[model samples]
Target: MAKDHTDPIKDLRHNTAQPFEAARAMPPSVYMSDSFLNEELTHIFSKDWFCVGRADSLAEPGDYTTCELAGQPIIVIRDRDGALRAMSNVCLHRMSTLLHGRGKTRAIVCPYHAWTYNLDGSLRGAPGMTRNTGFCKDAYHLPEIRCEEWLGWVFICLNEDTPPVAEQLADVEDLVAGYDMTNYTETFFEEHVWDTNWKVLAENFMESYHLPVCHAGTIGGLSKLEDMVCPPGLPAFNYHTILKDDQLRIAMAHPSNDRLKGDERRTTFLLAIYPSLMITLTPGYFWYLSLHPKGPGQVHIRFGGGMSDDYAGDEDAQSNFEALKTLLDDVNVEDRGCTEKVYRGLCSDHAVPGHLSHLERPNYDFAQYLMARLEEGRAD
Candidate 1:
């Protein structure tokens, strides 16, 4: 059913405007309202530094991946000179979208008309345009989009005015500098469309308060309520910290790593890079989800993870990693179930938000972030 609220935007403001001790879950209508989602699409998704994936994933020239920002199709590729680039994925000739998924493409060729483009996004050739008086192949090319690499991750910004990826995430860099996350190698990449609002999953990751109950079958046992620490978030991101024991292996620093000391070696940082990138970075490994809303009811997720370079070569580490992957997959199953259920409850007519726990500090900050972004958009 469509949301029948008078003003989701007002409700959003009123809900997040409260003090931390008075914070409650945001009104469900904001998650279900078309107008609110459109506000987010315009303000948040369009103007933020959106993380796509790791840079090393496209090491070779011609390697590319496709994504959607707001409603515009985008392509991120490595050009002949080995520089990372982004451009409109739609063909200039007839507006057909180029590239579908991750792959190595010699050039961007439109499936609809076979209009060929160079790796640099310039027009290469066209099927049949020799007779058109107005046709000038040299004058046509795909519009370039801004792309950048911070550490080893690739980020695409739709709004040219948005801050550079490095500056926006500078605090985050300082937080995980000891792990040297750029050296982390991506071991797997997968995409999933879950039946839930994107914020539901984002909030789920923003706090560890749910780990004990929602993830009981898997990672639940690893975390305790007393140890979770949620602090106030910065303008560009929010984060929390939890301690990991040495027994978790990948969650702890490798013996060769001399950079981390004491708790620093075992602490796992849950970073919510604003808009929609949630990263779980520990001393030895990291995983992340880059989310996009499919609609009021679903979210498209770019899921991937990897091991640190410190674990570069060890047969036993490989064995443990495979086991770890299995465990993580189980954890995802638990999260999907929990988040989907939350969305269902939000859609209910009688749904009312409950008070937030102190452990939900990041989530409260996220709501405030949304309001701030929306207000900024309104000002523009």
Candidate 2:
């Protein structure tokens, strides 16, 4: 049976006034309905810049890995000369997916059609079609994707005509300028498949209103929830930020094993890039992120952490890093638990749009930005 839904945020107190007046009211269906999910995938996911993987993944020439960008199957590889390249994993002949996972592949081969492609996405060979009239070796190569690496992470845009990654993220460089990310190495990697819309997760990350309540045991006591500062709203290019207090910084920077003390301790600067990429950087540690939309009610989150290669060989540093990973795990558990419940309420008939506190204006801005992008695609 179709569920009856209502706004969960209506007739409630708002901590702030103006700007969000138009967004103060929206249906819960926006979070739980199948129709809404389909629209988001079509409009927002397909066209946006997406973080794919860490640059370290392709450390050598002929190194390739397969990943999906907003549901579009793509493969990234390091060519013979060590340049990184992104290409559609789909075969030209049968449209079958090409690469499967990470490895050193001399060339990408389609299992179904046996069409082969070079590391540069050029067609090398195709069995049984050497003289096919419709087939032109020059024009039958795999489709290439636009890709760029920023701060050690690989980002790809499926749309060939999309803006350059550096230009698109030009506005956010200052937001991340404070952290010394050069000290981090890839120490932790994780992914969570949550039963909720991607926007819900993104919005939750942007706001700290639930920290004191939802993360009481895990983070509430460890950080200042009330003083959390959110940068006005999401940017024109799909980015948002949440600034945590010194307490949160200390907890993350203090390595459990206590390898480096004194000046090593520093602040944690977090950045959320549009579509679905989250980067949490401290003076000595960092978390790389990639969010994939699985369905209206599901999202696949990819997270990776890296520390400086100098720290990579330090046994004490590696052990101490568990403290940061543990903290992140606790936060993730708390977040996923609450968001799952929110998903249930959004699908409930008793639900209504909830009010945003003045502190939650950042959350409001994120939602508005998302709605704008989603709406833009629907119009086009």
Using lDDT, give the best candidate's number: 1
Q: After superposing candidate 1, which stretches have Cα over 4 Å from the reference?
A: none
lDDT tens digits by residue: candidate 1, 321-346:
88888988999999999999999999
Clashing pairs in 1: none
Using all chains and alpha carbons, the TM-scores for the candidates as numbered come to 0.98, 0.82
**Candidate 2: residue 235 Cα off by (Å):** 2.0
Best by TM-score: 1
TM-score of 1: 0.98
After superposition on all C-alphas, the RMSD of every candidate to the true structure, in Å, is 1.0, 4.8
Model 2 quality (TM-score): 0.82
Estimate the overall C-alpha local distance difference test score of candidate 2.
0.67
Residue-wise C-alpha lDDT for candidate 2, range 1-380, written one tens digit per residue = 12445221221123122366444534566666666666666666777778866787677888877778767799989998889998888998879898886678888888997889888888898889857788888887777788898767788876666777777776666555434343345655666689976767776765667878999987776446543555564464333333344553333444442543453344344566776776765655666657777776788887778665544555577565777688778888898899888777777778777556765666666566566676567577
